[model samples]
Target: MITFCKYALCFAMSIKKNNIRLLQNQSYSWLFAISLLVFSSLSYGQDTSVSQENDANKPVIKDDFEWQIILDLSLIYGPTIIAGIEQEKLSEYLMPGLLVDISYKGFYLQSNQRRSHVLLGGTELGYQLFIEENWQLDLILKAYMQGYDSESLIEYGGGDAELLAGLKEREVTIGAAIRYSQYFEDALFRIDFAYGSSGEDENENHVGGLIIDSFYSYLLPYKNWDIYLGAGLSYFSQDIINYYIGVSPDEVLATRPEYDAEAGFRAQAEIYAQYPVSESWSFHTGITHSYFSNNVKESPLVDTNQTTQVTLGVMYVF
Candidate 1:
């Protein structure tokens, strides 16, 4: 009887260890897969030249020597978890930002401060690589931060009460993207492929990821109102999913077990309206809803599978 009990215990232990190993290997495989996808997508149109043989006579907007500057102020509210903590509700913030653009010939230097990944606001620096009538490619560097403060497990009275603090810090990534845009009578379609990786996060965690985005929008003009309706779809790579949502062995506690996050997808819809109040000022309001995938929603850190964001702001052009 004693021998049988011991054997049973050993078998259970072996099974648990095997499961953890399997998850680790799968995460690594996903990382490799996204890397391959990024490389292939960047090389897709490298050798071919887009022909303008018959369209050369078409008029092009050559604002080559122009410098565009804009200042914006807004109130934004949303919750996004970089790693699970219950205090993400406090992360909502106000944004006062600036945008500057200068172009010479077809090349441009641009900088914009705005909300980026997970609703975290930051600055983006980019250089236009190839620009034409309908397509453009850029090399970009972006700064990202989850928030200044992280959530503590004690804030939520659960089995995770003993878990450590979950504060995340800022990191930066460098990447490239190719974007194509087409306009019809009153609607426009845009699609882009972007991939980036950061060396180490504030928590010393490795982070890298890829995203593909497609958007369709329509503009309707009524009196002094410009209404915009837009829908977007984005694919998030497994590496990124794991970094933000997965729980590793070191992070696992009694209540949080190891989780392996697969690639996920997001669908979003938004409606925005802009009304000119003066020659230099405009008032805008927009609301957006984003739905997360199962892979991300299944994470122990995630409390909700969907997020809704609303913004009311004013912009001034200089």
Candidate 2:
């Protein structure tokens, strides 16, 4: 216990020394990055529908294409450390998104790939390389890093608003990915090897970058409800890290200095619960926590090493 206390003390001191946090806010300006993509569909809110391999009871599609549509409405409340936070303030966001999944033969396009794998998010445009009963492989273009505009900076918690002003807008990072997914009766696993490319954002990053992601989700089917537990780990090369959190030489200030981000890792875990009200409507809620390593935390542009959020929503399948 004494050793733990000492370690905790040292960690606090390190954060203070590194200038990692200006203030803790109830929300982040990058809310779209988390809310829009992460909880876009019924996969995170409502349960997914999948056909098992070797099961002859599945229905055959009579059309030239297969499609699924989901509409989601959610309220997200969270604690964030952004560039500005001064008062004791928290934020709540009402987020809405409509997702479509369409597949013709082995070619597919998805707005929320979360339905493909319980632990994955964002858009996926891909061609299936191989598909067997319980496993599948694909070549894909995957979008991950959520984009943010510079013009809409608000002080939700506490920090210097100027720190986020006058910066070029950041765009979503879409990269080429080789992905593998495995489905089980009550669980899902996925892994991806991605090579990032240049984004449309004004800021430019170096070339030759890699990102690795692995995730797992387990479902607990209670008599009256369904619960999903998930965890994920991602590793990014220096170039990829720099694009999201780095401070260019030209944008440096006395308070927000230039920061060159190094290769780092992010960890995420989530728990979601759903209660069905009818054949097409359900109540959903979830809590997610994401953490960054020192390579990201040390940057002056980053305020906290971690963020936690809770979501409440409803889902409708059409």
Candidate 3:
């Protein structure tokens, strides 16, 4: 009976050991499977995240086309002079104008007619190549026409009598331009550069140079309104300035022979508010300040000093 008892004890211990081994193997198998599943899921989630991030980085494309038309009128309210004659009081600076713009796929065609004492008109074809969501390069081809009165002519002495005799009151300009625009959530900023040629008479040769312009606009958060401020600067060579501001040598000799009229620099500033009635139309009002340099202002035939103007108009955006 004692021997039988001992054998029973040995068998029981053996069974317990086998059960332990089995449980250990089962636990290891479960752990391996769980680890593999977790790793696979983690890898999948990482891939999905990367894909979504790449898609989010892509730019939004606008495929629709739009058109806008604008009309403007303004008055010169302060002491102002057109060419050289000083008009002491508020006079009619009839600035009746139209602007048309058509845009498609980030490209635009623009045409404008503006009179501010001088009849000015221009046409431009431009393309916007976006660098990012809020930045773009604008390439443009522009042609402009500006007309001045006969009194605005700067007299030049005896160059070619025939050529001088045929000089007309109109000056026409054609130019090409490039501009950069940076857009913010509530504002936009831009800088532009241009080169152009102008001519009045058949004998007059066209000259071209740098034209710089810049503007900043801020949108008021409360209302359907925007405030815009801008300035422009232009530089032309002596040849170009002489073409426009030149006085006749004979006239110079008779008057102030020491005065040399030539193209220099011009600067102007404008501040405006636009209140939108709808998505397509708006009421616009602004103040403009124009200053001519000593070279331009000193011309006896031209009023080049500081001049201020108030303008009110309507604009449409498509």
Highest-lDDT candidate = 2
Q: How many collisions between residues are there in candidate 1? A: 1
Top of the candidates by TM-score: 2
lDDT, each prediction: 0.49, 0.58, 0.45
lDDT of 2 by residue, 1-318 (tens): 000011111222324422323312323533443345434443443445321112222222223687878776555554443445322322324345566777887777765322322213666788888777777788888765544444433322233566776555555566789988787877788788998764532334344478887777777766546677888888888876776677777777777788888998888798877665446655667887778786676877667777666776666678
Ranking by TM-score: 2, 1, 3
What TM-score should be assigned to candidate 1? 0.64
Model 3 root-mean-square deviation: 35.1
Q: In model 1, what lDDT does residue 75 have?
A: 48
Against the true structure, candidate 3 reaches a TM-score of 0.59
Best first by lDDT, ranked: 2, 1, 3
Error of 2 at 13 (Å): 36
What is the Å distance of residue 71 in model 2 from its true position?
1.2
TM-score of every candidate relative to the true structure: 0.64, 0.73, 0.59
